[model samples]
Target: MVPERRRLLSRRWFYLLLLLPGLLFALPLAEEDLNAIRSVTDFYGQRAGKRMQAWRELIQRGKQQQWDEKRALTEVNRFFNQMKFLSDVVLWGKNDYWASPMEFIGAGGGDCEDYSIAKYFSLLELGLNDEKLRMVYVKSLTYQQFHMVVAYYPTPAAIPLILDNIDVAIKPATQRKDLVPVFSFNGSHLWLMKERGQGQLAGSSSRLTLWNDLRSRFSSEKLKRPKLNLDD
Candidate 1:
């Protein structure tokens, strides 16, 4: 995995890896997709250009500084939580859809799943082990609706920290009593959650249809109306 290679290489070599084309653009916005972002935002009159510029700065700052795991959690959770939440029907014109991180930022709004997806990918890009982060599906007792969040395990056994859009705070899973875990997943594994967010390994995350669709469309930006002002 990239994180393994990152640990083996010196800090000097790690920075060089960032330069490799398509290896990972700090943010994966292509010129044409960016143009489309502008076109849609023109009518809305929000500064899409400036918002993206701020995102670039976040990526740069995160890379230059050696951030701790908790610091990485705070930085990423706070950044994307700034975006508005909309239903899948409103944002993507579907009953249920999952957007990639770039698509979530490009459109300026998405549902809970979007917040989790963006955080999961951004954390990985920041060099966290893929195994340490899992996207969890939970039943929100407060709202009586299904919701999603990103859980960060310092070690596989550590009580995971919850990164959620609704709360927009990094708290331990034990503190999130309102959320009843149903299951969890990442790129490699799927888990069937038992009581209190603990999970039993199920299978590959490929079992998730929406997640697979999101990955397939990640490189190809699907232009939607941009409404977020990141600088705001």
Candidate 2:
């Protein structure tokens, strides 16, 4: 009986030893994964903070400039002309979904969507009416993939003026049917352009949810880093 009891205790000790090495290895890997997640979160948070700061500054400057609609539109066009359109590097780079405008402004890089998004927010800050502006997502004719642009519609029935990085000139939306519209969103709303159709209001609940999400997620701080000649 004594011999049997001693053997059982010895077996339990052996099992404990076997488990120790595996746990030791797993701990480091777990720590590394946690650290990676933290790093990504921090990066996005910092970028968002920067974007918010930029928006504030831009708004203040716009107020000081006292630009009327015509002058503001001209300035916007000039600015678009100077900016290098979104590069493939910026398009493919993995980053946060809601990239603060500040990140784009800071890095001097962005994709088509980034340019449209930034411009849309900037125009809004400069006093462009929310109802008149939208960020349109579409399938590009040349690239055969998703792309985006800001469209300005003066009236409900009027064709929108396209603000695109692919072309320097602002053209009528009707002329660009090659761009199949997927959806359109703005600072305050989202539209199911292809299905619900353009000019019709989206569901209030959906619009409110979208508006809140965008408001909370997007930041204009990157613009504050330093003014780059954003003129196209």
Candidate 3:
């Protein structure tokens, strides 16, 4: 091979490797999930179909390819942030409602908490460790309302990266001056956060009554997954 062509091929191979995490083959989806998406289309129409199809592809591709953590964060944030923002009252006829990833996509939109919860689950499905992710509840000073966002903690004591639908740009927690974090939780524990960092443990995530109800709905209402958040 010519020197130039050899280097070009090498560079191309390197880029290809970046997209391949482990398995080159795509993951299989259950028939019931496919039926569920069709039902969503029947009720919610083509727009919902589009959202559900895209979400399905995102999970399948993320699972199929070996996406680096940064790529996982970027794609998941971008995918969910595209969802239209709707209040719980407007979307679910409630003061506060938490939707599963399927419900969030099927409805074609949701509140901040929905965005965060969806992103958190998507990453988890892609094989990201639960320890590295949190559903954070913060006060959005910009909007003067309680909000929810997903935070990626690279290390236990590391300054976490904020995955917020409101800002739509993943930045370190220190850079998000407009949000004052009140608390954070994952599938395991909950913490009351101080300004920019995690605080003392409050309790297990099961203590959040809404989250418990949401977990049950994730089974009867949507696709089954290991039982499992808020707005952004």
Candidate closest to the true structure, highest lDDT: 3
lDDT of 3 by residue, 11-62 (tens): 4553343334323544565686577668667656665655666666677787
Q: Tell me the TM-score of each prediction against the true structure.
A: 0.76, 0.59, 0.80
Q: What lDDT tens digits, residue by residue, belong to model 2 across residues 90-141?
A: 4434442333454454344566766776777778768889888888878888
Ten contiguous residues minimizing lDDT sum, candidate 2: 223-232
Q: Which order, best to worst by lDDT?
A: 3, 1, 2
After best superposition, candidate 2 residue 193: deviation in angstroms?
1.8
Candidate 1 lDDT over 1-232, as tens digits, reads: 5985675454334233323322443555557646645744553344443444445445556766768777888888887777768887766678888877666765666899999998898898778999899999999999999999999999878899999999987889989999999999999889999876558989999998888888887756554443343223
| Residue 71 shift from truth in candidate 1, angstroms | 1.1
Task: List ranges where model 3 is wrong by over 4 Å.
Answer: 1-33, 222-232
Candidate 1 positional error at 232, Å: 15
Q: Show where candidate 2 strays beyond 4 Å.
A: 1-62, 85-92, 195-214, 217-232
| Distance from true location, Cα of 156 in model 1, Å | 0.6
